[model samples]
Target: MQSTPSYLWSTEDLLGQGATASVYKARNKKSGELVAVKVFNNASYLRPQEVQMREFEMLRKLNHKNIVKLFAVEETGSSKQKVLVMEYCSSGSLLNVLEEPANAFGLAESEFLIVLQCVVAGMNHLRENGVVHRDIKPGNIMRLVGEDGRSIYKLTDFGAARELEDDEKFVSVYGTEEYLHPDVYERAVLRKPQQKAFGVTVDLWSIGVTFYHAATGSLPFVPFGGPRRNKEIMYKITTEKPPGAIAGIQRQENGSIEWSYELPITCRLSAGLKDQLIPILANILEVDQEKCWGFDQFFAGTNDILHRIVVDVFSLQQASSHRIYIHSYNTTTMFLDAVFKQTNIVPHHQEYFFEGHLYELDPNLQARHFCRTTESSPLTLLSTSEQPEDVVGVQYRDPALDFPKLVPRVDVVADCSAAKSAVGAAHQTLRVGQALRRGRELLARGLHWVIGNLRTECSRILEQRRGAHSVLACLQLTEGRTHVLCEAVPAGGRAPAGLDVLRTRLRRVDEELSQCSRSIFDFQGALDGILAELAKDGQQVHEDKSIQQIECCLEKMQVIYKQFKRARTCLRLGYNEEQIHKLDKLNLGSLARRVLSIFQNGCVQQYQEALALHSSRMRKVCEIKKHLKRLSNRISSCSVEMMECQDCLQGALDRLLQTENWDLAAAPPAPSPVPLSQARQEMVLGMQELLEQMRSVTCDLQLNNSIIERLGGAAPTPSV
Candidate 1:
């Protein structure tokens, strides 16, 4: 027996235990730094000295951000056995994350990227060090949310790892059965006689399995009675499948095994991502070992993806905000240009500001500087000329706003078979009732998002209307000044007389109108612009796929609940199309919208054309035309420049009659939209109705829960 050595760290909570050692959460006595201490038992040390020291030697030489940092080798204060102190990962293992109900369908897109980077880097590090991590499963990868709040994954547990050059082969095999390459598994576990030696590429097979699990939350190959009972069949499915199959085989209900390489619909990764990822998995999971990717080729493929991932910037607010994707390579100036595409604010006029700091107009600063991940801060278009552009110009919509993420459904179908007994039925009902209650809560969250979006849109429109009115009044003032200035100028810049004064007046009016166009477009074009903006504002709201999906689930919930027993409150939050449309509702007044509509009915296009003419012909433009307009002039001067520039006013008046012609015939008036106030009132009333229903459902759930407890169904049911 080995004597225990003095400890420099406290060991209170056991993190995990294995055949070789028990790992405990420990803190450094001096530094107070958290770490994991792996204490080797007498049985572990009883093994050959070389085998026991292999892990320690290998881990000591490894140094990479993706590989766990080794702090010190010590001894247990009590047992006097060797203990390895390593970096503590508070977030636990990737396997633990996969076990989460939300992650059962696999990690979300952003999360999967983190895992990809971490694993690839770790594996590459192992390869560079001429070391092979024979076991590369999720269980061996530890995760901790970094100071930046990103999941920092690190490879740990070098028990099965050994030094091996790329071309060199090791005779012994070491890995979890499911993740092991077919060649190794056949010899090591199945005990089949085989001459082939395991090489570093064995790790590639494990990586493919790990990625598959991370992507789909399940193993790639399976057979009837699971791998343990049907190990040979599982091997056949993996080995006998055609090259580049990337197949996932599983047993069906009727004793049939199905194989497919396609990512399931339940997978959270998008089709575009799958396009990039599936090929990589296929190359790695090749049954023919020779065709598999080496670390270099693998790095190239992953790097391509990492470099192209756009920064998904949000709007003014996070909870209720629009998500806009901008290329990661875009500079702050370029970032504003991307925002301009969505917001219609020209780049020069837009200011990129967030994080409570004005990012220097550093043209060299890339958007990726702020985006360590695919998602970044909400994008706001603040006009340099006007009062900071408020939420009026900020489009606020998130996919989360439309979709309600629910806990994974309990396995009700299996439980239904056991429903013959009172306890069974009561247990099933309890499960269904609780699931429905959770569903209602998530649905309530969806409703809250809807209400928030509606209220925000309303506030934005009101602010927009007020800003528009203020700008229009200013336009009318600027228009009067332009006319007076035009009449006073003799040569209209053809002669030097009054040219400076004329230029100053032109610049001021140009500045005023430019400011207006940046915020809400010209006063003449206000209605169409508002309507256009409205369409943009409600763009995400119209995607009702989430609502449809929710409805389908609700129906399924009803069906499942019906088989066991009926609970009226289950799946009855009164979710309907009418209530769903409230997500698109706005409380901007009907009178306000109507008045704005009347102003933009016809002359807006011609006014812009005339303004454009003055801009084009005279080098006057809001860019101060983004630079001029609404000049109400009676220019009496006979100078050629005066007549040409006078077109700004005369051309506008002449084009006024042409807009009604935009409609070819006398069209019947469309029905007036329901008053916005009435619409808002209806939205509020619907919200109240939903709240009341949820409260009622909650009460019923409580009653149902009490009944369930009386029937001795208080014990937790096993999750699916």
Candidate 2:
């Protein structure tokens, strides 16, 4: 380095602090630029000579956008201690973002993908350089916003990183306790007698844990009192065969372990994304080294997800919507092609509107333009068998890569009374026409939004309604079987050994079914009430009606503008310093502003009222949708649990039927209870019915998204 990076700012202005080092935000005096100075404490320096120098050497050698840039090594002015000057990340760490209350359920799907992409890229770089990041966690990953205003993540804190080949092993344990591999935890934290060496796969285990935490906003494995308090259980839970991305624990010390094969219901990642992610996690977080995916495979899997574009799209012709995944960069043409493949609708026959603006097929038209993330409203695709003519709509798309060279103090579309020339007046008229057309389309959209919702909700309700009846029928059949078993057991005689388990499972089924029924009924009631309220306040307004109203208001404003122009011409005929100035300022400009305001007020009264009503409905719809979603999740989970119950019940029923009094084994075996056998048959069939019905009742929300490619001249809307 020509000149050493300086720590001119106060050390007290800290950016982050860790166990071994304190990072401060400092300004480099040599170049007058901001940088992060990592000053190690004496404790960090006391490590083995190689260990102390390894981090700096590795960081210096590694060069990637995802890896923190090493500027220069310098010394503190006060103590003359060695320190590091690295790239400054003003956005802080990934941990800070995760800690926000809003992200309690983990990052939104898009942000999670970004983190996944950056971390994978960064790790791939490290692997290429033969480096192992022994301690990988969210806190160690720094976040910085790029010039494009999107987050760029960099791997930092190389204190525990070292060069390691694929087969190389080091018999040392170093990692956060929560993220430590079972073998490492046993040797280092457990202090057990062992001679197992750690390899590159240990980093995979850590990465798995980090990814889990990032995806779920919590660690994968935690016992009653954390990893430290119940070390053996945590180790056992992790090392157990048939692992999943999520970890569960037994309630009691002596109880059998409980494991979940899926992420929590509260996790914000979409089902489609989660389906792709869980497999990668399963490959990476394996307890058995032989089964874990190597770096190459890991890179391939993550890059696959990153490279594929997934978004929801809504088709009006089909009166339905679904998610689409594009393997190429998401451009408007690419989007239309993707839709064509999925829906068999030709691109030429399709008309697309995003956020009420028509999407014109120009070079600038991209995915960002059509970014409706919510299931309730997706990117609108108007699919007709025949192509339409003269599609008049606003198609100006903004960009993120650069700003337009706009003229100062200039407006694109001058309002009435503001046009000073014929060309300007023509442009203003065209603008008014566009605005009226947009308004008309908005009205159409509002109407379609409500009708589409009614169609979707009614369909869902019908499915759930049928499911409820099936469950009730199953419940009735189950009750009948249990009654038969009750009849078989004498009034005070001891029941069969397996009878208790059978009863317990039946009780669980009963409770879950009741919960599902209540949720569905409540959802139905809310939907009915909202629809009725809307129906009462609603009236059909033709698109042309609003356009006519606006057009008439514009005509009145144009008349005023002509009269003002004539008056201005008369005033100019007498052209004087005092008279012209007064006429232009007090009369012309003030009257124009007042008339335009009046004109706006007159035309938008109906529009504003309808907008307010729609906004209110949307908010109510949002809340109800959340409730419905929660209910849907519960029903789906209940269905899975019921299937498990059916399995357990089948085993118990088998044992119950096969039971015999062993004391009388020498004698002929007692006759099998015919009533009990009949009961078993009924219960098994009924349980299957119950599960099938519950599965059928699950909420199915579909969305169709065709986003304008990134800054595709428009930004994608973030989902709530």
Candidate 3:
């Protein structure tokens, strides 16, 4: 038997067989490298010659790290039993790992990262290489566990992939049912009558499903009938919004998952790691492919996210971990210095009383306590500093990673004297007077600390100056730093220098500092405006509450008036003049009883009304969501139809080009108006026509996307 050099593999030991193909562990006798041999079923291969050609062509072009390498093809046997030889991985598949997540998983983040890296690497590589791995699932991803028990993943099985040679065109009905994109699937089957054409983005839809399984060890969108029944499920997953990225955070009281028993490594992990994964996963699982990263972009983003996780959570604490925590009400001006010191990631902040003092930071910095405030929920900020792990009375510094955590929000309020008094008071009334005073005191102290730090640093810089040039340079540098300091301090706090001289000299050093100080004046004006607006709003709420109280009083008065009229009526009737006169002379006690009765009735009615109104609003929101789902289905269908039409046109053009190139090579040196001249002319004309058609089609597709995006109520289309 004769074999070619490319024949690095031959099937020997059978690994397993699926419905479509049988996989075998094999070795190249020549190179002596172990490999996996996948033999396509005769039915799927020989049924149509084009199918085999397409599969072979796709596999040949794809060469990537995460994707399983296709080494060779054997075409020797008379029966023509075709085989695809790929790089063999020791571990079998992701399905088995998921089946026993709690038992076999080494570390959750590590496991997730492997799965994330490999799947994304392969998918992205494929997309970049002009292919879409339509079938993306755990079974297709093979893993190998290392000595450290970490899983390394490799994406396999591109049999279902479609070659999307053009980015603008769409290919229809080309993925596994369970993993099929809703828009593409809808278009393939014509769910919507009017919708046309879908695009290369369908691969991202499948990736969303893949990510869901990777994170929670459960499918976000499961099909009852298995992969084949995923058509309808995909529609729901893609068309309807899944919970927002922070939905889990909202559902929990403390924004922490309640685990029955903590996992070994997870218990030691940072809170940032826990919170960060949710948002990253949420972005990956976005239904809109445009919002999700393309293969290259996804990997780049993955690297950044992974690097942050390692620096902030896994690696030893260093200079990078000394983060500045800000309050939600904090201005951008306040953190201008911090932002200038590092790459600007808006510092997270919250409005909270930490250690009996109220402070505000920008909400972006406050991971644990953003968008949370209620009677039951008091606030605190997570401080990041170089403080020792065993700092006296500190509840939160980590020895392993060396980070600090704020005392929980609930504790902040409970530990306060005012809070304890409020609860103990007979009237159950909250007195903010003491808490306000304490918060003011802290603000003053923090301001003084900022000014002192600025003064000390400035004095040292100026003192070291020896020459004319050095002094000028020192003054300029000091001015910039000082301006940043002043902005960070609260209102009415003095800057490092007096305003008049500082403004004139500072303007010469850096326009930004000068501009920022001016901006402060603008901010102060804005603050005044906000205060005025708040005063108006406060009056409105007060007036409404007062009106409600007055209405209650008037209602009681009505009952009294009615009783008085009845007494008068009885007196006029002359049936019981003595009794009527006695009733008319009613005392405070009797009048109070009647008034209380009316007031209680009104209060009950108000409660019932409020409940009814809440229920009505909830129902309306649900109804709107349902309509949006149906509209989404319609839009997806349209998208698919449009995609299919575009694909057909693109495919036709590709065929024409392929044929034209063949003709150009085969034809003898052509003369004008020769035998093949007309044919060649026709092909060129067809190519030109196809190009124009593709352009128009692409325009239409973009318009449809904009419409869908607008209807979905998302932010306006971001730069692709």
Which candidate has the top score in lDDT? 2
The residue-by-residue lDDT of candidate 1 on 1-720, one tens digit each, is 221242354345777777788788877665666778888877897878998999899889999999999888877656667788898999889999886534656787789989998998888888889999998999899999988999999999998788999889888877889999999999888999989887777898899989989997778887776777788888888887766677656665336457677776556675557767888888888766677887777788877776664544333211112334445777777766655665556777654334433334667887778634223333332344433232232111211222222223322332222222222222222222332232222222322232233333333433433332333343344335434433333333122333334445444544543454354334324334433433542452344233333333334433433443432223432355224222211111122232223223312222233223322321211132221211211000111122222334333322321322212123322344764455434433433343344334334334433333343232322211
- Model 2 residue runs over 4 Å out of place are 1-5, 9-11, 30-32, 77-80, 250-256, 314-322, 329-720
Candidate 2 contains a number of clashing pairs equal to: 14
Per-model TM-score on C-alpha atoms: 0.49, 0.49, 0.39
RMSD of 3: 37.2
lDDT of each: 0.55, 0.61, 0.45
Tens-digit per-residue lDDT, 24-110, candidate 3: 877676677777877777667654576666667787888877877887887535556777778788778887666541312122555
Which portions of model 3 miss their true places by more than 4 Å? 1-13, 30-32, 76-78, 101-107, 145-150, 185-196, 223-234, 242-271, 288-297, 309-720
Cα deviation at 302, candidate 2, in Å, is: 0.4
Better of 1 and 3 by TM-score: 1
**Cα lDDT tens digits for candidate 2, 103-154:** 5557877789989999999999999999999888898899999898889999
Ten-residue region with minimum lDDT total, candidate 3: 311-320
Better of 2 and 3 by TM-score: 2
